[model samples]
Target: MKIRKANQNDLDEILNLFTDTISEVNNRDYSPSQIKAWSSSSKDTDRWLLKIREQYFLVTEEEDCITGFASITNEGYLDTMFVHKNHQRKGIAKTLITALIDYAKENQLKEIITDGSITARPFFEKHGFKVIKKQMVNRKGIEIANYKMKKLL
Candidate 1:
């Protein structure tokens, strides 16, 4: 798999990856309504473009298909990170996070933080992120549970 910076052309694939991974990988932990509320697959091109431009989004692809993605901010907030459901536990997430961590180090970021879903918290924990708190966040009037996790550089 090759990890590369995202371009405008990758929007559709990115959105699909996000939605599919959320539904398939998170269904075991989240309710149907919660997943729908969270992913909300309605394509908002402008919003996605903004994320692509500002978040320094990156994607990993194999056989011309996107396998995973991760994005981070200058402030070291890991805004988005997802691996295709079928590609989980294959070091994709780790590779994504490792790239972000390297970026954080180069940019002098002191730590990295993210609100991780139940399905993702364990993965982050394995990467040295500790849970700061558990939170109930509302999305589309649906309450969803998550953990605010952080890792010191």
Candidate 2:
């Protein structure tokens, strides 16, 4: 697998990966209703596109297909990380996070933060992030619980 900066062409695939990952991999930790409300493709497409355009987006590709993606915004103040379900546990997220951290360092960012799902909290913690709080974010009137995690750069 190769990791590189994301381009506009990668947006659709990245979005699809994120949607599928949330519904499948993340479902183990989040209820179906919460997952559906939080990651609904309809609401996320525009947001994903905006992030891809405005943030430092990176993608992991294998055989010309996007396998994972990550985005850091506000000079790394916020981040969104996702890996294709089929590519999970294969170091794809590690590569994506490494790239985001490098981007943050290059930008001289003081910190990085993310609202991490239960499936992702351990990964963030393992990567030096500390939980600042447990969050209950409502999406489409459905309560979705997550952790507010931050890492000092």
Candidate 3:
């Protein structure tokens, strides 16, 4: 797999990956209703555009297809990290996260933060992120519980 900077052209594929992975892989941890509410298609186009345009988004590609992606805001916030369902447990997410952290370090960012889902909290914890708080985020009127985690760079 190769990691590279994401362009606007990658937005559609990234959004699809995000939706698919969340609905599939994240189902192991979240309920169906929570998944549907969290990854609702109604928010895709606009949010995808914003993430692609404003954040430092990176994609992992293999055989010309994007298999995973991570996006970090300029202020060192880890906005999103998702890997394709079929591509899970192969270190793809770790690689993408390592690249994002490296970018943060290079840019002199002081800290990195993410609102991590149950499926992702362990990964962030393994990477040295400490839980700051447990948060119940309302998505489409459904309360989704997640951890607010942070790592000092």
The number of clashing residue pairs in each candidate reads 0, 0, 0
Checking candidate 3 for backbone clashes, the offending pairs are none
Per-residue alpha-carbon lDDT of model 1 for 6-119, expressed as tens digits?
988988888998999988989999999999999984367798898899987999999999999999999999999999988988999999999999999999999999999999
Index of the highest-lDDT prediction:
1
Against the hidden true structure, what lDDT does model 3 obtain? 0.91
User: For candidate 3, what's the RMSD?
Assistant: 1.1
Tens digit of per-residue lDDT, candidate 2, span 34-106: 9889777535567777778898888899999999888888656556788899988999989888888888898
Worst 10-residue lDDT window, candidate 3: 41-50
In order of lDDT, best first, we have: 1, 3, 2
Candidate 1, residue 35: Cα displacement in angstroms equals 0.8
TM-score of each: 0.97, 0.94, 0.95
Q: Which candidate is the best by TM-score?
A: 1
Which rank order by TM-score, best down to worst? 1, 3, 2
Q: Global lDDT for candidate 2? A: 0.85
| Alpha carbon lDDT at 123, candidate 2 | 95
What's the residue-level lDDT of 66 in candidate 2?
Answer: 91
